[model samples]
Target chain A: MGKVKIKKKSTFIDMTAMSDVTVLLLTFFMLTSTFLQKEPTIVYTPSSVSEEKVPVSNLVTILISSADKGKVPEGKDATEAEGKIFISFSGGMDSTQVAPVIRGKMLDEALKVYNAQAKDSKKIALTDAQKKVFQETNMLGTSFEYLPELLSKSLTEIDKEQGDMYNPNTGIPIDGNKDKNGHLNDFQIWCRAIYTVSKELHDNMATDMGLTVDEAKTLGDLYNAITKDGTGIAIKADKDTPFTTVETVFDNLQTMSLNKFSLMTALTSEEEAAPAKH
Target chain B: MAEVQEHDSGKKKKGAQKKMTIRVDFTPMVDMNMLLITFFMLCTTMIKSQTLQLTLPTNEKVQKEQQNQAKKSEALTLILDTEYTDNNLPKTDEATGKTVHNVYWFAGLPDTTFQTNLLAKESFMGDTKENGVKVQQGIRKILREQNKDVMTNYDELKAQWKNREISKETFDSLAKKNAADSTLTRPVVIIKPGPNTTYEALINALDEMQINQIARYSIQLPTHTDTLLLENYQQRTGETVIRPTVRKSVVY
Candidate 1:
């Protein structure tokens, strides 16, 4: 505790290294970032304890959102006549109600894709140009009747002017109406289209793996060895959408014998709530 | 004359060098970088979404189940119904402040005995936190108690997995094995959402089923007996009740 020397040394420490590091990190994040895809609707998936990840490929994602009629009813035993989904209704069950709307753009790239060996364009009912657009665009919610128009329009133009063509309360119109031979609604037609296109891909893989196409349960099986657990159907619905809507969707699947599907939900990181327990 | 010129230039250069300094204050740059990092951190959705795989029975299968399995004790039916006062009519619940939801829960068929003891009317009151608490307190607690044995076994397996004594695959297999064991009691749950039941309550009920580890469960349509039970329940309670109606989907 002797002499208190008040010599002020230079306080400047070189932050050049730190700056370099931050810039590097920023660059890395910028390069690696995968931007969120613009969805037609904001689907707030319900939280759950189940942590099974959705399969990556050979999947058809179904997005379901509610259309609010006005103010939600409040009270015990409140009636749910307030909200209505905007979709064209066909007579099937109590199917007039609980219709959903989504818009899908057929990607142009898929129309160009044909069986190199067989060149079987006749198998499907669409012009090559139409098929190309159908394959290229994202499958949006629209009535079955509007599919032809959807096929004709350029997806990029639709993307730019999205709101003008927004058909409310319409989805791949499925009233669970099966034909004499068990053909479901527009939803099944969409699935058939996918299956027809993917047949070649599945066939090639099946052949490669020394399995017949017949043996491979492609449509309904969740854990198809050839597909490696591709659910094919991925349903993304808002937390508060009526179960009637979802059940009808399930009905559509059941009609088509598509039994297995995946329900998408947001993952909750448990570590967020952890106290300082080692 | 040249030596004199050089000496004057050198003197000029030395004077210029003394007056000027090259320095960069990077505090602003650092601040900008920090701001950007914070923005990205806040906006970025880091975690990937999870999924729940479900296999649904065909409509025919459900119909058969209703016909054949109603007598079974484990055949529990959970009908999710919405509440709107008759005055409110088609919709709109101006009278009640909370979103009125109810679950008409019962196990086995609506025999006189089953109706007397099995059926209970419960409200879907949001979660424990919210006044609308539809979480793990009411029907969930009851189901949890019913499936406690399997849940306990599954929990034990999970603990073992956490302690690194067993792998996840092993744990899952063991859990499956335990769930399938006939020695342990099992409850077959049937979930039926009325035409008006909000999607949230259905999901909450499904979530409850998973949380309680009740393995055998299904989403089914309400039967005639179920509807009758609801009518009886409404009459007894004298509360405005929404009836559970089937969607009449044909999947056979």
Candidate 2:
């Protein structure tokens, strides 16, 4: 009988389990990760030792940079090179000088709503005299025609003055034109962007469970709910900010009834006994 | 050889060869992964969401003191115009003795006269010819007077506070204390810069004030609200009232 030769057999391993694990990790990250919504507008915040956490919801961020001293030396943009940042009030723009900006916007929006509702309900065209009488009698009939006109004219004058004061190309008017919504277009755009980013993340999370936009409210509500229930908002400001600006910002926040906010700072490895004086 | 072959055949035939199988226990790996995820979740600091809220001071009629009572709390009015110098000092022409600087004091009113008069009073202990010398003397004198007045008022107010009189004297003392405390707390320098005064000038004034321990001060803004009736009465009657009643007045 012919002697049979023994041949070595090589083992072939399957990678199906490893592939499944990799896919699971990818899905996990896709489901859990959060995306940043807005490009951070540079704001100067004063340093603080307080460990209060700033809430993440309904946050109207105000950028308070040091005020620009004067015209920059040749070959430099004033905003870029000059270390001047004013205490900007969110929604109001300039809280110190033009506080009426926010009130004006709110009034304008309310007016538009009233106008739309009145046109639908009354279905009657009235003379100027009749309109005046209606305005006096109606509960929601406070006239906004004069206020809107006045605001528009004043804004135009302000734009003209600002144009004359600074280089037109460099200094943009905070209020350029009212949008169809009767709100400042820039502010509206900012709000829209924030809403979109937050909504997108929230929707993505809900998508796996087959949730719709109407069903899944934006993330802002969650943040608001959490914050409104006594959770504080945390703010992290850069060290170069002036104490006055910080105080002004703090005061403004207090005035707005956001007293539960806290300043964010770098956590030291060990808690120091006392804060260091400048 | 025949017996050995038989034995080998019998052994081979005893059982059919079985296929080798491998099994992996994923329980330990899953446990480690879960532990890692829990650790990360525990270590991460959660950030809170917040918004700013503010209540602006209303355009109410805050009472202004009577002229005679105003004497107790001297108003160091500094008018800042657009042409304020880098040091926040009004620019003065030595040759012409004119202020080329423009200010918003009274809608671009030339403040040279006011500054010159104020500086002279603040710095001069004795008559001086040099402008700089006079300015220095005037400032020194004004500061000394302010300190003396503050100390005296504080003492008087302390007595009245103990007695609960709450007189105009007490108010004046309180204002002075507030101003002094503000100066100490924040670096504010009061400069009457012209209406066209540059931001740099304002900052310079603030810096100067900070250096001189006068950091907490405020630039006086013109009163836009309706004048207080009490203030008007104080001015007319020359009487000091501790508390004024709040009443609405007809605009007409």
Candidate 3:
């Protein structure tokens, strides 16, 4: 037997098939994957079993951070949190390096489209060349009057506290105040702008399908649709933030007649538990 | 690396060189593909964040007709506020390190004018798990009981669907319809989060509402009667319930 078994064979095996499968898988993931949006301030939303997905379109995100584990300056009142907030959209063109500029441009373009079509509407309209340039913007935390400075001012200094969005000054002024003539403040204005653009898109899409404006309302009335589908308005607040602040935010929304919204929460596996005071 | 091999066929033609075979090893290609797959897997976010739907009723001025709407027998009001420690301020739980949230709940109005009874108070500490059997010892138990009607209906629908007596769509639609019907005997929960209540507490309370499957629920500022009850409860029990400044200017 030893004399007969003298032949040696090469150990090479073709791996072409394995490589083909792996390459296919890689391409599938690359094409289908959606990247997580980079939040200016990281937050741990309260846990719940609600598995409803945040809508990927026509979303207006109101990011709020109050008492964001901030350091109290010596001798400053510790109770008064330097909280802040900002408005973000689902169509966030995340060029983080030039966030404000790109966001501002997007807002600018959206408004131009919105205003051009609002010739007969009763609502107050904005112009492309408004004295305050809100088009070249970052996460806007300013008023309508101060928007020009907010847009043009170099973003380097403004973006410093962006990491700590709890920087009190950076939040859009949403003090739960309504103008004497009954108008949404700067914060609500931004929300309305997003909604207006969404409505325009909805109308455009409907018209393309040979539908009328009245028919468009049933399809996508940005106000109620936002509230109904994909949490129309998501108020992401810090867990420890006082309810008054949340209430104030809600109060502002109510003033705009935007009565429907959703709250963002983390998914937790823990079984439903309640506060133990029976 | 690929190497050429001379295949010496038994039959050869005149002036024809031996046929050569080129075998290319794909091990390096497979390794690169594997690396790419791993990178894509790590970079991709497969799970999207979840959203909990909430609808705030219009903040329009209340009409006389609405004010005249009589209160039902099963109307339950839950006052969410923070529990304070020695400093008369909100306290965090020692175990979870989260703020200790409490509920001042009642089936109806508490004795407010010259009242002496202690207003019922319970903390929402659902952290206890005993032998895999959860001990329901909190205001949740009462809320669950109040919402039993819907649960019973839901169970019936689920059982019917399981037995194939009803289609899944019919079962779902009927179940939600039954739960949301205000004319039914189910309890109506009114949630009022006090100023001191944390956002987590409000969310938890809302979660409780969802868990209970209660349909006739609303988030409102404490009404005048509720305010009176709270004042009496605070004076009598000495529980640190933050008296949220009722914005007299705004109406729920």
DockQ scores for all predicted structures: 0.31, 0.03, 0.42
Report the error of model 2 at residue B8, Å.
24
Sort by DockQ, best first: what order? 3, 1, 2
- State the lDDT of candidate 2 residue by residue for B128-165, as single tens digits: 44755422232323333444434444556657777778
Candidate 3 per-residue lDDT, tens place, B1-252, comes to 256687766376675667777888889998988898888888777877777888776567778777633265677778887665554344777876667777888774344554433357876645357998655557767777777877778778888999999998898799879888776678878888875677778888887776667876778766676667777777767763555443211222
**Better candidate by lDDT, 1 or 3:** 3
User: Top TM-score: which candidate number?
Assistant: 3
Candidate 2, residue A69: lDDT: 38
Mind giving the per-residue lDDT tens digits that candidate 1 earns over B45-74?
A: 557677777777544444544654533767
lDDT of each: 0.56, 0.34, 0.64
Worst 10 residues of 1 chain A by lDDT: A269-278
TM-score computed on alpha carbons, candidate 1: 0.70
| Reference-based TM-score, model 2 | 0.27
* lDDT (C-alpha) at residue A197 in model 2: 35
Docking class of 2: incorrect
Interface RMSD for each of the candidates: 9.2, 17.6, 6.3
**Error in Å for residue A187 of model 1:** 1.2
